[model samples]
Target: MNQLKKPVIVAFTIITCLFSFSSCKKDSNNNSVDTDDPASADPTLTLVWSDEFNGSTIDTTKWNFEVNGDGGGNGEAQYYTARSTNAAIKDGKLVITARKENYSGKSYTSARLTTQNKAAYTYGRVEARIQLPTGRGMWPAFWMLSAKTPLEWPHDGEIDIMEAVGYRPDTTFSNIHCTAVGYGDLLPVPDYGRTYHVYATDWTADSLKFYVDDRLIVSYANAHLADATAAYNQWPFNHNFFMILNVAVGGAWGGINGIDDTIFPQAMSVDWVRVYQRK
Candidate 1:
């Protein structure tokens, strides 16, 4: 367990004078305030979850690269590749890219990475700092799924912590989905695309809170969702879950604007992902 703190947006997003990142600097939101860079940032909370990717290659001990399109929810269009275009680790960041080039019988390519077995958590605050891939027809997500499915999908439960489709530049979606038995909710955050932003989800025994910076966008009260048996009958966010990071192209949710050939090999760089729990 980690220390607990109040959920404040500015404090959670970027504490001034500590290591605040302005998207204009790197032209990509993938970099956080460099620890040794000396740029001052003032944040009250200490580091809990982070991937300062300081190595020459992916950290096999902390993450696993998902290398197949077959597991992409049945409608994902891109074949996952291990190449730099699809995914690569460089300059201390994990970059996930979506491409339109043909490869191995698929017209598009992308990367999906996860911390399925390395780490799993039941609650607290989970955050991922990210800069999105540009152009139309792209879908990127920072999400989680129950590692131990009390029942299969629609039953096991899913937490779409942060998800955005390129066509809607200003609309961000923070949602949850369950079996057809329930009409899950898709909470909206309208400013997710205009710039780099941190998407967060806070969970406790009775509810889940969606946030964009300091704003509490939506709250899912436990009494409103799923049943006790873990069926799609309710919101099932009570179990341990693993994380997933991916940029998908031309899939059912992504292909809306049509693929932009000129933006081939666009990337969604992640600054880091950190989790918290009640101490």
Candidate 2:
């Protein structure tokens, strides 16, 4: 009787151990987020500047819209509009929407907002919490261009903090463009449309660090920033740059998707945009 009782006790103990191990394994996949409200998120960054977009309308005082005629960007077929139809503030967020409607000869419509005359920064961490738009022919971006460019693009340079095309919803890219290097795009992830992620850049005298959701992706050092090599033209980023936000439809880069009229008024929603200077 004693031996039989001992075997039963061992069997029970083994079963309990297996159950606990299974529970731990299940918890590893439950990537739970905090229960805190977005508005209540702690400010861990130094607020050097921002466009909260809190007003009833786009605070034109801090931003201006670009209205590109039908042949925008040199024959690109997008009639960029500044109207509220293209961009608006609703429920405490900035929405840049694009549609496949004909206002005139142009077949597609969208918005492009800029801070060229409003804000300029030489070195700082620029961040935006954004979610991408879905469907082909949709192109959304957060970027910067030379604030004081007398000539044209490529000469002044371009910095793409984040750019995504609906056709390639799986990937978002960050790239630097100059006359010498031409242009380069990289794959940061496979699927960006599934969730809201933080797209950010920390630019300093030393280098620029690219991050997504506090996770570091790549760091370009000052040497690379100042590199005079023909492949990496340094003139573009050495000067000040202003910010731009937009959602383009059926353009050179976006038009590759043909057109999806069914997904009219697709929005690139931005939760927040913040800039921080070093302490």
Candidate 3:
């Protein structure tokens, strides 16, 4: 009887061990995120700056309003307003709304928020989690500009982390704009207006890698910008750059087809903006 009982207990122990091992394997697999970038999972990346938009109001210390309606040289229709109706913080997110209403002689009103003089960084991983607004002429962008004074645009280099046109709901863009390399690639992704997606750029002295949700989409190298004759023309990114977030209506890109007045009061919702640097 004692021998029979010992066999039964050993058999039960073996089954229990196998069950625990299988459960552990399943949990490990489930915890993994679909990503190719090593830094996406690396624990060493330090959060240098971030805005979660937790309060009832936007933190003025971090962002300033680019209040104007001059079309930004793009023939945009929206008059960018500095009022809370156009830009506000609610439900733990920064909401930039574009409305089809007359304001200051413009047919539409929107908001452009910037971190120009308030915050700037030279190189790091800059990203934002955003859900785009939808409409015929809606154009939303999360981009960067040189922090230098006198505001040289393309000469200073522009880094468009994310740009989406409402006419093309299935595509977005990421590009490095300079005199030498001034082109962008259209990336087709799942409908960005339907859900929040992360748009990010990993920038270093030698390269700029664009990513969507940790998946690398395109990479632009600094080899062309390294030429001494074209350094100023191409590599103005050596200095710090500040970020801008805005939604424009009926601009050059968004107005390609024309504005659909029915989609009034469209909004681009930003969950958060984060900047991480190597530790």
**Which regions in candidate 2 have their CA more than 4 angstroms from the true location?**
1-45, 70-75, 182-191, 224-232
lDDT of 2 at 73: 57
lDDT of 1 by residue, 1-279 (tens): 000101112211343333354322221233345332121122423334556565577777778887876627546678887776677776767788787777777888888888887888888777776778767877788888888844377566677777777776566667665543322234444545444566777788788887765357667667744455544357667678888888877656666557777877788887657675555
- Across 65-174, the per-residue lDDT of candidate 2 in tens digits comes to 98876444534456879888889998667988887778767877888888987888888788787878888877788988888757457666667787776676676766
User: What C-alpha lDDT does candidate 2 achieve relative to the native structure?
Assistant: 0.65
Model 3 lDDT vs. the true structure?
0.77
Error of 1 at 170 (Å): 1.4
lDDT scores of the candidates, listed in order: 0.64, 0.65, 0.77
Candidate 1 Cα misplacement greater than 4 A, ranges: 1-48, 149-151, 180-194, 224-227, 230-232
Q: Candidate 3's residue-wise lDDT over 1-279, tens digit each? A: 000010011110011213444311111113232232234466766666778787799999999998888886688888988899999998878999999898889999999998988889998999887989987999898988888898766677888888887888788878777766665566776579888788899998888888887777787777654467677776777889999999988876778899999998899999778777777
Q: Return the TM-score for candidate 1, rounded to 2 decimals.
A: 0.77
Q: After aligning candidate 3 to the native by TM-score, how far in Å is the CA of 136 from where it should be?
A: 0.7
Q: Deviation in angstroms for 267 in model 2?
A: 0.6
C-alpha displacement of 78 in model 3, angstroms?
A: 0.5
Candidate 2 residue-wise lDDT at 25: 14
